[model samples]
Target chain A: MLPTQLSALLADPAPGVPEALDLVSSFDQGLVDGLARVSPSAFGGLVDAFAGSPLRDRVAEAADKIAAGSISDEHLFVLAGARSALFGAVHDALLGQADAALGRTRASWPGGSGDAATAANLLAGSRSWLRELAITGWRGVDHDLVTAAGQTIEAALAEPRLRRLATLLDGLAAELRACSPIATMDRLPVRRWGDLWSRAMLLAQDGGRLTPSEPVTGRLLVLGADVHEHATAVQIQVHGILETPGTAPRLVRTSVAAPKVDTIVGPAVWRLFAAHPVLLGALAERLTLDVTDLPLLDSGDLLWSDARAKAGPPADPFATARVLLAGAAAPAVPPLERHPARISEPVFVEGYTAVDGAFTLGDRTIAVDTTRLPSCGPLTPQLVAASHACIGLLRWDDGGWSLQPIAVLTMVKRQPVGVHTTDWALGPTDPKVVKAAAAAGDAVAVLRERAGRLLRK
Target chain B: MDVERRSVAPIIPPVKPRKLAKVPFVELADGRLQGVVSSGSDVERVYVSSIGAGSHGLSCSTNNNRPCGGLRGSYPCKHLQALLDEAVLQYGADRVARYLRIDVEEGRSLTAGLRAHHEPSPAATVFSSFLRHLAYLELPDTTAPVPELHWFPSVGAAH
Candidate 1:
């Protein structure tokens, strides 16, 4: 019930503010006259403006299966996820009228207002051309929104309102040349590694049980590992969270594996948990565990085989990530219902701050993405400018929304460190992880003595 | 909300490779110059070239589009001169000679300001963006926030 030029660009004196570059050239001529009234011969007037809409019977059953050319690839991924949820509800109602007209032109324009920085760079090139027209009408169904709408159309063609809307930036440079993976790898949605191991064995036989199963103590923490390798196996994974005194923190992971040696390249998950000393003493006694019977896999994976451990009481993983980012929420599932190749979404943040490489917090910011930690290690921009709780995987690279941290929590000399107990992911038996693994020379003790002579031949 | 701690830097600054194993990926991006080279007689091949700014339009193929028989004629191959020598060692020679509108002079060298031509172009979206940047090192470390990584770009056009 909006679209009267986006309800006069979301009302309240925003019908083109203090002539903000004539309201950013009438929002680049109303998004190139709303992409020539949603062409394809005005798509039956946008499916009769979605009649009696709840996306009008899935936009009239995806316009009668694209007028009967017999659709299917699961109705072309439900008609490109219902035309990207109807152009993401008009790109989230023009990002609430371009973040309230760039927060009222940065709180009442004035000083050095080159027309309020060219009307806030033409309202950020009309919000990267309405977010690349709602991610090119969503074909290429989310590979992290086609890599953040091709880095928001390469930072919206470095806008100085690049000649207003040159054919809507040449159809966002031909939808960033049909976002390659050989052009949307046959429009995704095939997903089969035996349907992700039969949806992880039907999410581990229906909701991997736990309710009052007795033996459920906690305090695990850890949160970092990730190694990978593959073509035959090297895996690693690890990750953590547990914290069960008065419940609510869960997300776990485990993995490990090994074998794939083709000349041991990039090893490090603390040199394969230092050549598996019984999986590094069951991950150093499940990082100070007070656990029993772990198994639980309703996707928060964790099964450390017939687990049962003791040593607890000493948890300060940044005060359990400030009681799990003050009781998290706002996730109610949906990352393609949790994980069909889950393209990044784990968070945690805590008292942000950091600065330049970015983090900030209250007034938002974020940025940090050290290329989503390629085989972890360097989180440095001087250790995220001396942290105070980070824990990573926010995603979308280069053109913004960063945070690939992994584990942080700071303090050091005044004690409380925890980048999984320093020397990045523990082990070398402390004395400050054997003086930071002998000043980074004992390359994980020569790759754990060549992976313990190739796992004892 | 005093938040300042300063440090900024990143309007562009993100090229840094210098060699990157014979053009493992170059950039300039979309307006073109592009990347993903590799193949000198296949160490498991790669190609995905590009050029295009100011109709210098060329391409080289292989991430399945095939082509690249040393992309003949209007010169420039040897994997597009090793992706213009690793995009002049990750964007330098006067910003890849002003993003391929090549002018070069002072201590000239962005391939001595050449003019390439062959106009082919698709190499599966710059080798599907170098295999989605090598599938972000096979993911799974976890903490989870990928709601399309909060569709970034437009912090009021950054600076």
Candidate 2:
């Protein structure tokens, strides 16, 4: 049904050479149908031309009709492929502009169910500016397109309930916001990229370094581009040090490209964290929790430590761990261990309070002597609750009875380090305590020394 | 005893003992507990004491963002108070010879049901940056917008 000139243009392998105004100005549904039935190869060029224009709606409409018909799977495949490459971007840019020009619009379209006529008219009317940006990647031409997309996204974000708008816009806003032109990096397995991401993270720190003392298998030394940028975009190199059983630690070199909008690092990273949180888990010492709800990091904020004095302190592992546990159903924990002797006559001591170097329990006011460990002097709420709930090991002397709480036990649910298992266990035991204690001194010194040696070389 | 004197072996200065993977805690003469707490990226020397000899009624050297309430003549602040509580748990009631009576009596009720507050360690800092970057570079095909709860807020003065 398309005219001969339009049909000829659709079949051209290397496109964009058509008499631009004549071909686009007279676009119609028959032309799209002809292209779908005949020259599917030219689909990509079609998208590039009309992506942010009024013709996008018509393309969507035609594609929908074709999809509903007895169209061959091959034609359908070509159409599907071109939607992402062309229609999706143009649709986003157009809607972005429309929403901004109209101001605080309602979530009416709901993705596949927009008022076709209105959307078509709005987009068609905006063609003057879109036509210029259609073919060229020049900066200023697409300003309204990009800005509108950004603004709509920001508005939707301001009120979380507006996510219904996401489905309405055919998810164009999101696509536009997170859109990147790089080749897919996710095609690579997590294990490969995980090492690169971890190493780059460590390297980003001031003297950032990690060498798990335990000899890990598949000790990979990766040299890749920065995780945030595409391999082809920029050329910042990073190295990964893999410790093999017999071989010297291998140094793998890597590089990373910068993001399109440097400001996008936070949202992009946050989304990634949401999708594959195990990536973060791989780096935790004792546990790793979901950190997607954390605030966005500023440009270069991720490089700073949680203990930074001025601003943008690092994310609190303990708080993150606690919040993660609180969000889910509390896992079944090991039953509280009870003293064998006191099981039958478990003393329900009431109104216990801290006294001078001792504790007074029950109406009798019996003083439980305190410990010699200076670290053990202060009484905490958990210690109090445990004392009330469970009968502890007690020693009776000339002064009276004394109880020493065995341990500060709380059931902590988290994914264990290295094993990738999520389970709940009574924590602050010897292992966690030891890990925390060692982190401040021995672990720091060891890593620092190793780094110093590496620097010396 | 002059049996062909076994050649006195030369003493190689004991291989500078490979720095222990675990830092050793030193006990001061006054019964304070000093040790390096290492949880991966965080490494620092922490000192714990039972008696508050300083003007503040506490002798801990750990850094805290909030002022010590115990220093203000109120109940021991969460920082010093946590130290005392940890000391009791670290060393059983038998060995610790001294403790503040006010905390034993009043501190229990005041801090009851509250989770013990811990100072952020250097290791925690390392993990934050590591995890952040790891998530940034590698998650594939993120064109779809994530739910709002998953997005983290930028750090502001709220903390």
Candidate 3:
């Protein structure tokens, strides 16, 4: 109901133009509050609809302009609609009770508040509610109060602002109508989007953690280590057979879908299996680096040496400064104690692991989860073979580290340009880390070679 | 969407030290360096390029002291817009938009997207000395003037 109407109901009612406006405002506020209160179910649609809305700034500006006379009040209805939405949201979130006055018998009680903070629980509850409610679309929020408030604004059919607000709200409501009511309630008693994330279950391909790092030759630097591929594997967990306890568990695997290229350009995806609303909104801010910058601060030609792969491996990481100082006289130092580092060929296909900080292949650093590690000392036979396709190898030189990129077989370039040299561990998954770095390095070598040949000719 | 990816044709005429009078060094967007000098008799122009993509633009008074924090020079930056607006006021918006459409929302700026790209100005010199080094390329369009700048984005756009 409009504020004036609310005021009237609270005391002696008045009938006038100002009163009518006040009544509209009061109703608008209540509706917005109600919408907010019943979010996830009744109000979430409005919030989602507003999140990255292209017309958001425009709508807001139009409203402000009309209110301030900077522009015509043609936008008054739009403003009123938005205002009412806000008020409805708050009401649905805090005050709206889910008690059905009429006698009823149902067992959909997944009650309480504190548990809202646990996303797993929230997600489970949401899923259950959807299944039980058979919710094919956004569910209706049965807030008598909000319904009444909406009516008050609707009653003022002549008010253009109020009418506009109703039109937009209708659209928002349509989207909201698809969710389950109880599941809609985020952390609030009814529903409030601010607490929405605590109860949502994110999806994979939506994101990933920092994958391990790999060394790459300068030749592999052509594509830079920013390249990556996202995939999902179905995990099967089968236990007792439905027919008998003796039956072996048949593997039941679940496969998630893949994301698109736009989704590929985010660190959030690099850190988690899924993306959140806020993070998705921030996607536009993320940067997709081109492999071109690796050449700066480089220490020189190990990457472009034509005979690298065919030639012997780099000087052993264990080689002492005294030995390195000896130069060529010292036959290629044998892979030494601590293996000082692990290395990768520019076009190597296998993922690799490093011991103690001796990251080889073109990488100086690699982020790995100790738990996900294949084994302790050096690299396990499995890891070595798996990580054999190195982007580059790390060769010890005067106690300093340098990378050589393995040419990516994909690119026809003879030599790669550079290597990624960052120290941040984006995450700790195997494919996430090693494979990601490998893919990036793979592309790098291809590009670097192309650029090198381009410059050469 | 039709970002002209034409190869850098090796058509530049060699400059003779005897005839090539160098320009005085001056500050540029990137602190590294740049300078401008007149070369050809008729036009006084310069090819503003940078080593890092992030620093490729003329150093306007405002950004002179600021390092351009861009992947390859902040495209559609205020400095670029200012320059374009000035150009629009001088040369006319229609012409500027016609020859080099500046698409702001799509991340295109006249200076960054339209101006010629070259290596970082390691040292400042009269930009006019290498005027021919620059080439104008088209950029995508901004949000507001979508349809006006040739609709059909779906026809092609890498993004």
Kindly report which residue stretches of model 1 are placed more than 4 angstroms away from their true locations once superposed: A1-218, A221-241, A252-457, B1-26, B29-144, B149-159
The candidate maximizing DockQ is 1
State interface RMSD in Å for all models: 21.0, 25.7, 26.3
What would the TM-score be for candidate 3 when compared with the true structure? 0.16
Calculate model 1's interface RMSD in Å. Answer: 21.0
Which parts of model 2 have CA positions greater than 4 angstroms off? A1-144, A163-457, B1-159
Q: Residue B20 error for model 3, in Å?
A: 39
State each model's C-alpha RMSD to the native: 22.7, 32.0, 28.0
Task: Give the clash total for candidate 1.
Answer: 8
lDDT of each: 0.43, 0.26, 0.23
Tens-digit lDDT string for candidate 2 (A64-170): 54534434333333333333223233223333332232221222221221111223222222232222222222212222443443333333323323322222221
Give the interface-residue alpha carbon RMSD of model 3.
Answer: 26.3
DockQ score for model 1, please?
0.02
Off by over 4 Å in 3: A1-245, A248-251, A254-457, B1-159
TM-score of chain A of each: 0.25, 0.19, 0.16
lDDT for each residue of candidate 1 in A206-296, tens digit (9 for 90 to 100): 2112212123566566555444332212445555667676866655554544322111222133454443443345443434455566554
Best by lDDT: 1
lDDT of 3 by residue, A19-107 (tens): 32233333233233432222223322333344575547655564344334342223333433443334333322211111111111112
